[model samples]
Target: MLVPMPSEPSGQTPPASSLPGPSLPTPLPAIAALPAYVPGARGDAAVPPIKLSSNESPDGPLPSVTAALADAGGLIHRYPDMAASELTARIAAHIGREPAHVVAGAGSVAVLAHLLQAYAGEGDEVLFAWRSFEAYPILTRIAGATPVTVPLTADARHDVEAMAAAVTDRTRVAMLCSPNNPTGPALTTAEFEAFMAAVPTRVLVILDEAYLEYVTDPDVVDGPAALDRHPNLVLLRTFSKAYGLASLRVGYAVGPEALIAPVRACVTPFSVSGPAQSAAIASLEAGDELVERAHTVVAERERVLAALRADGWSIPDSQGNFVWLAVGEDTGALVAHLGGQQPSILVRPFAGEGVRVTVGSPRENDALLAALARWQGRTG
Candidate 1:
């Protein structure tokens, strides 16, 4: 015997009553309430839009990666290798960790979700800075966990001390996005070390270095160096940014075997596609030739920053491939205003008007600069 479920657009679950009811449990309220992710805009409709949105590699994937993808064409008819053994091994060697300590996922973001799902749930708390990565809170909520958002300091860098203070016995994880997305600032090694020391051993600490390649700061935390000392520390990196493999969707995690294994269990088998695995391997082999592109992006990012500052915009100290324009206005207005100009440009604008612009080729960068100059004239 079963109770009937109402078939409305906003279906209401049957209330407890004197009559017998269906045993099916209702879906978690948190899961139902999560918002859909809004990806950055693209295509010609955008005006003066030099899309510096979504911190992707401006140069695109490597030639070897394209060749590997071609080689994998025949293999696509069959399911990909479930383990992604070769890619995992190459990633382990690349990160100087044992293969058992690494896990490959469809993307770094997917792995981050897996980590949260594996470790967090109702009654558990996940802590991170408010403006770190937009995905952090979404993933935390999706995992049925409470999100403890500590606002970033005035300059828009993670206030490590504040984040550390927010942790409680109920906290299962603390996530830090270095060279943090949108803001483009990174945590120094000493600051991170001290912060880690303050956090309890039970809580997992995630250092997401998706933009590690573009980092030129000598004081940046070395992901591997902290791994041995802090078994709870997990480092996530991606080929999407500097290696120019965003479309391929491959990223990896390096952590203790305990943490790595559970997250691996949650991943649906063969989530990483055949072409993605092949391309990642090829990119790893290419080494510095693939990584050296960061130099160009870093150099160009500075040039972009200089131009923005000269025009009287407040720009943050960005070590990533993108620059953050801290305009204390509505980002939608700024984005729309920029969208009406020629050789259009697009940027990722957030809640309070912080816009992130990617460092593109010289020509694309010049286009953005011209638009900014015009925008300054109008606003002045």
Candidate 2:
């Protein structure tokens, strides 16, 4: 009755296998079903690689943004503005919206997640196009809501009519990703307006314009301009892509004050760091310079697309800062071949779907074209 637990031998600890394991709680069943969001591969560090992955700006953050970040560095000990007041005001001013109608989050993804959390839950459904942003279904499931997806058209564009037809009584949110990821064609204004007419007013519509800055197409849906007409509409914009603040993570949503209030409530307190807010405000101030840089990327995108088409690749008309190559089952082989090169080229591959190549600097773009030429030769 008084026996003590046996002690370990001198200078030796008991085997980890013999220890009593900690009990852990089980996760939601839906979590296991969720697919992982695979980011683009980062090539080896020994050699400098031509990285055209992640749709990031070839030229990093703007000069003004960098300067603001440097100035904000001294405030590292302090917590960020919980309301993100200054940045919110700047965004509202930039978009000609009221401050009360705007809410800022770490990034557009975070803002979108908050929106889902606020409006969707068990028994509700969130709708979006298939093969759009990979995060859509993941975030929808995380909110304990059912994800209803409509397939993209054969041209790799949003089948708006199909998406609108798929909406049901359970549908609480519908997301439209203009200039959709991996498949770069944007949703036209007429297509969007027709879809909006078909959808019920109760269902919230989110227009994700993350690549709006790089869009050269005149007919693409302009989210902010249409916000006045669709009270249920929410416009999502990010500083990550065109503003080149991917590392800092700042994005905003503009919508009706009533809906925005709930989205703001769902955001984690002080999640938007001080430096990020400062950089975003600085980025807003440098609007002209940002526009110039975006134009540069758009020009390069056209050049790359033209070259690819001339080389027998049937690419969609991309309005975003990237191009999509529908390589079908050859995705893995093409990705490997590109990565296996001396100065490897990194592009986002969607297994059996296609590859997304970011518009890089002139030299980097040339390198990518050269790599494609070599691959074509080998495959033929």
Candidate 3:
């Protein structure tokens, strides 16, 4: 009874695996069925390869944003503003909305999750187009709701009529991603208006415009105008995609005060850091500089898109920061080959569907095009 204990060596830590712990609880059944959200491939430290995977800006943050980040670093000991009050005000002024109607989260995706948690629950149906944003179904199920998906058209566009018709009494929310991710064709104003007319206002409609800055098409849905006419309409926007702030998540939603109030309640307290808020506010001040960078990326995207088309590839007219290749069965092979190139180009692939190539800088894009040519030479 008086035996001495075996102690860990001084100045060394015992491995966590060696410790005995209480019985862990099992996760909900839904966790087993959730599809993993695979991130874009990253390069190893040995070789900093060309990165064209994520839909990130090919450029870095603005000078003003960097300055803000440096200044905010000194305040790490303090908690961030839970309400993000100043950020809300700036977003409202930029988008011409009242501060009460705007809410900020770590990212737009987070904002969407908060909306779902507030309005959706077991037995409630959340609807969206198939093969759109990868997080749609995962988020829906996580909210303890069912996901109702309508297939995209043959040409890779939302079948809005089918989606509107699929709405049922149990439907609580519907999402529309403009310049739809991984496929990239923005919804026209007319298409959106018609869809809205058919759906009941009792159901919430989220129009995700994460790629708004990269959109050059004039006929795309007028988001602000739509929000004014539809009480249930809310827009999800992000600073990650084109604002060059992917490292610091900063996104917002704009809608009527009635819906925004509840969504704000669902957010995790102090979810956004002080540095993130600083960068976003500074980004707003440098709107002119942001547009210049967007223009550069848009030009490169057009050039890459043109080259792909000229070489006999059929791709969607992507208005977003990336382009999609609907290579159905050839996805795995193409991605594998691209990853093996001299400098190694990494792109996002949705196995068995196609690949999504971010529009990198001209030099990076050139590397991608060359690798594609090599792949075709061996296979074609």
Of the candidates shown, which would achieve the greatest TM-score relative to the real structure? 2
- The residue-by-residue lDDT of candidate 3 on 1-380, one tens digit each, is 46554698899877888775668898899977899988899988698878889999888888899999999999989999999999999999999999999999999889999999999999999999988999999999999999999999988888999999999999999999998998998999988998999999999999999999999999999899999899999999999988999999999999999999999999999998999999999999999999999999999999999998888789888999999999889999998898898788889999899999999999999989888878778888
Better structure of 1 and 2 per lDDT: 2
Please provide, for model 2 over 1-380, each residue's C-alpha lDDT reduced to its tens digit, 9 standing for 90 to 100. Answer: 46555788889888877865558898889998899988867777887788898999889787788899999999999998999999999999999999999999999999999999999999999999988999999999999999999999999999999999999999999999998987999999999999999999999999999999988788998888899899999999899999999988898899999989999999999989999999999999999999999999999999999999899889888989999988999999999988987788999999898899999999999999999999988887
Who is ahead in TM-score, 2 or 3?
2
Clashing residue pairs found in predicted model 3? none
Candidate 1 per-residue lDDT, tens place, 360-379, comes to 88988998888878878888
The per-prediction CA RMSD against the true structure, in angstroms, equals 5.4, 1.9, 3.9
For all candidates in order, the CA lDDT equals: 0.85, 0.92, 0.93
**TM-score for each predicted model, relative to the true structure:** 0.91, 0.96, 0.94
CA lDDT for candidate 2: 0.92
Cα displacement (angstroms), candidate 2, residue 280, comes to 0.5
